[model samples]
Target: MEAPQQTEKKRIKVGIPRALHFYRYFPFWKKLLEELDAEIVISPLTNKKIVEVGVTHGFGELCIPVKIYYGQLLRLVKDHPDLDFIFVPRYVSEVKDSYFCPKFLSLPDVIKILPGIPKILNFEVNVKEFPISTAAVELGKQLGKGQNKALNAYKEAQKYFDEYHAFLREGASVNQALRLVQIIRPFTLPKKKSEGDIRFLLLGHGYNIFDTFINLDFQKKLKDQGVNHITIENLPESIFKTPVIVNPRGAKLQNYWRHEEEIMQAIRYFLTKGRDEIDGVIFLISFACGPDSLIAELIMRDMKVVGLPFLEIIMDEHSGEAGLLTRVESFVEMIRRKKKGLTVGRRNKLTIKSA
Candidate 1:
């Protein structure tokens, strides 16, 4: 008797856009999908072409990050025509009484308007309403997975997620941390720090601060100028537990926006415990970002009270490298001169008093 024919199992292909939350939660998604036996396709890094496409197709009022997300989605659709699904989760509230930006809440629906897009796996991630494990089980069901299998995958994924954060706490850049967790492979090992005379605390969202194309290679420029810097992602989670007093009436104000709370906590730490470590601060913000605009004002007021130098650079599609270079060079020069003047004044005072 002839043997019956056998068929190989087909793997489901899922595409993830390399924008926004990718910088924050990619490790978890990568591990989860792999555990479920799915093929993962990540969009390419941000480039000029992606920015142009995003700006053309995205809504006029949306921030640059959201616009770039559109561009990434289009690229995935165009490049991977055989993709089985695209993952675009709706992020509502991760904590009680705090929510993500409104843009994130509506991102999946917004991208559905794009032509020729594949099936989207739009999962709702509202920790206040349901745990992420529940969301994971539901997502797995859509991919034809059983509940017990999905829960097991989630537990494994959480291990990678925790390791990624631990790498960050050990002074790895976001890219480096991703590499450490085996999610990405092309990152350079971080260089040993030189004893640079000046240090700056770079405060911004992970999306804005780490996306090289959007920030115009801001971190590289700082290093090229022989200046050491730290970003918001480099700090540990323990610092955020202390509340920042934003009100002059001695009342503590809690931020309604979840991500903004990190920026606030970073400012509070630098101004108090880490004060002597940093010489100045440079804040990067996107144009028309509502939460950032309000937070920027508060940050400026706090910096002014302590008499620390602060530079706020507002970016958009129209932002130019020449202008950014000029501003950065000028800011660094000013800080250097101020430091020199203070040293000279102190020395002269000592000389006069001795004489």
Candidate 2:
């Protein structure tokens, strides 16, 4: 009894872990794979067993996110026997000005660490540098898709992704309503507040950015600035399509890379459409996060050219509030200066027009 032939099987199922940013990037992957005409299987929320299986699957000392992903993979393999190759999209950066954590850069290798993980893929999308066209074409070639078929699939996926995110941006207040969103991710986003408030984007991993103890007065200062900031904790429930079977309690956990992508989305949204609306972005990642090490490196370089002023700070268990405050103050001052210049520039243009 050999395995069934590829031709006789149903649609291939692509699995996405929800621990990280499944809430954020699900739209992009869902549309892309569907355009490829593939079915999707996202693992359910995180639970104790998922964590248990994760620890068992990983080496003696993998990080928490990797452990949780192991559990998700276990659930996927056990339940979805019809699943084919898993779709893992490699991403160096989401925008022209950003790259995620150094850890994110090693997602393909990391997934392989699971005890009996699925055949992880290598469809890397250097969003600005490579673009979807190139990645879709390559994936099509690998999966035996013709040029036209692959192109069509990629287009549909892009359309779906773009449309879905449009809805999210219109109403993606994920910072406070963490439990409200049905997706089993690390954080939950609260619902939106009243309008007429300055919107700020705090870009970082759930643990680092949300951990007030580590940052000390980060949120307080944002409130003081009269800015409402959002993070991974504030996504809607629509991102989860993959159900989990661990512990059966239905705790939502995201794949680490997924979280990275979501952060990129938030950053991109602010940088492009909301540049003027978003006063600034504060990027926070742990000191040794390889994925974010690179992300921080790239953002540090590009923020200069980015429309608004931004700040990148590394966090550890022992961070000083004074130093952090100084950095934040400097960044705020820069924003003030840019606003003044824009005002002056506009006035000069008007004067010339009148003359």
lDDT of 1 at 70: 91
Best by TM-score: 1
lDDT top scorer: 1
* Whole-model lDDT per candidate: 0.86, 0.61
TM-score of each: 0.90, 0.52
Q: Could you tell me which 10 consecutive residues in candidate 1 have the lowest summed lDDT?
A: 1-10
- Flag regions of model 2 displaced more than 4 Å: 1-9, 56-63, 127-129, 174-203, 206-355
lDDT of 2 by residue, 63-121 (tens): 55545556777777777766677666677765544465554567677777555566775
For 1-355, candidate 1 gives per-residue lDDT tens digits of 2333335467899999989998888898898988888899988989999999999999899999999999998998899999999999888987777789999999888898998889988667899999988998998998899999889999999986877677677777776676565545533457876757789999887789889999999999998888888777778889978655567486657888988888888999887888888889999999999999899999999899887899999999999999999999999988988887756555666534554
The TM-score between candidate 2 and the true structure equals: 0.52
Model 1: lDDT of residue 75: 94
